[model samples]
Target: MMKLDICQSEVGTGLPSYSWDWWTENEANQFPQELEPSTWVKLSEVPSSFSFEEALLLCQCSPDSWLAWIPDHGEAVLHRSQFS
Candidate 1:
């Protein structure tokens, strides 16, 4: 059970557009099917055993998307350029 804050880039400011926490339960059903459970981890909960590559795959994001880490903040997956 970790608090996963979903952050989206705002006007290239690298700020979070929206945030949410993850707690295994009915919440998973509420999210889009493409989002993998392991795609996120709170900034403080990032495990030492985890790797960026692993997160990328688990994210199951589109080819045009990219993941970025904002220290002390959280990890984010940038989707289409227009929305970012």
Candidate 2:
């Protein structure tokens, strides 16, 4: 699997407020099969400061390739497969 280092955007009141910087086609494809395209939107309510372990499970990311900053939460390393 390919690993992607993404910078997460700040949270907003509505959808599309968060974006993953540096994610490529291959990296996006690495997401898990159980993930839906709309899942991210659904989970957008998750606090930005959430933990890496929490983001891993929340995003269903593989534990090795994921990394992001959740505003007040801090930062974490997550897996590409988690967002499938």
Candidate 3:
């Protein structure tokens, strides 16, 4: 299984922006090779301008199980069993 850290952020005004950042190549390389690219679209709500909420939701819907890394808050791992 591949492990990825998901971070969501909102920017701009009016429509509420959203943005997402996947780990660097070096970081992603640490995961298992068999695992496919992780998806990030189920943790939170969608954003009008690609806000952080959209990223969180994407992470939740990721194909490969992922562990979320929240600054100062620790981590959150997604499990198929939980949602299914």
Candidate 4:
């Protein structure tokens, strides 16, 4: 399995952002050949140490980072951050 480091922007809930750096070609190359093309790696296909509830909390509370895998996406990471 491929490993990725997830990082969250320091910006708070007003506009929270998370980045999966491993999705890039340069970063993917650091891993096995299988991950050369990130499109082949679905977000849902990977395992994550976090839960839905935890993700929800992270969205609500930005400036937090989690080393988690990308979830399967139809087009792109569609998760949005919204403050209550």
Candidate 5:
């Protein structure tokens, strides 16, 4: 299994963007997702304490920086040095 590398630039900040390609092109049903939009881990690995994106971070299933995240429709993506 290929581990997704969380993108961290020299500035240590990322512009998390929604990639329908990233979201769709990521997996081929290797793992069951709790949330089809962002989750890539198995359903049992999902943590109730964290958001789905956070779970992706903790699981290291993303290739984008912390700023790069899955966004709900109409939700705005802002520039932030810190997430949450």
Candidate 6:
């Protein structure tokens, strides 16, 4: 399959209160249910400390690392970074 690059926003110095709950709530508003696994690639072996900032940093700092979607006390979703 043809490859595609993904674009994700960086937390930067803002969003000190960013957390998994915040993400899920916002997503819930947009999507009543989680998108199918095929819609978005989920990463593997996501770290327990996974955060959007951490994933972004990992992609920026360690390009080989996956974009991890780890919510505290929830299942983790990881994805290969095509843009990393």
lDDT of 6 by residue, 1-84 (tens): 999998786857564665443345555356423223223332333454433333331221232333333334333324343311
**Candidate 5, residues 47-77: lDDT per residue as tens digits?**
2323234223222223332222432312222
TM-score against truth, every candidate: 0.24, 0.24, 0.22, 0.19, 0.16, 0.19
In order of listing, the candidates' clash counts read: 0, 12, 15, 5, 2, 3
Residue 21 CA displacement from its true place in model 2, Å = 18
The candidates, ranked best first by TM-score, are: 2, 1, 3, 4, 6, 5
Query: Which 10 residues in a row give candidate 3 its minimum summed lDDT?
Result: 49-58
Residue 28 of model 5, lDDT score:
43
Worst 10 residues of 1 by lDDT: 49-58
Per-residue accuracy of model 4 over 1-84 as CA lDDT, tens digit each: 999998996655563345545357775456442212222232332233332211111121123222232333112232222110
RMSD of each: 16.9, 15.9, 16.3, 18.7, 17.3, 16.6
Better of 2 and 3 by TM-score: 2
lDDT per residue as tens, model 1, 1-84: 999998774665654434344445575456454444344433333334332222322343566564655444346665533121
lDDT of prediction 3: 0.40
Give the distance in Å from residue 48's predicted Cα in candidate 6 to where it truly belongs: 6.5
Reference-based lDDT, residue 21, model 3: 58
After superposing all C-alphas onto the true structure, candidate 6 shows an RMSD in angstroms of 16.6
Rank order by lDDT, top first?
2, 1, 3, 6, 5, 4
Q: Residue 64 lDDT in model 4?
A: 28
Question: In model 5, where is the ten-residue run with the lowest total lDDT?
Answer: 73-82
Candidate-wise lDDT, in order: 0.43, 0.43, 0.40, 0.31, 0.32, 0.37
Give the Å error, residue 57, model 5.
Answer: 6.5
How well does candidate 4 match the true structure, expressed as C-alpha RMSD?
Answer: 18.7
Candidate 3, residues 1-84, lDDT tens digits: the string is 999998664544356334445555676556344333343333342223222342221244355565554322344565543221
* Candidate 1 global lDDT: 0.43
Model 4 pairs in collision: 43-70, 43-71, 43-72, 44-71, 44-72
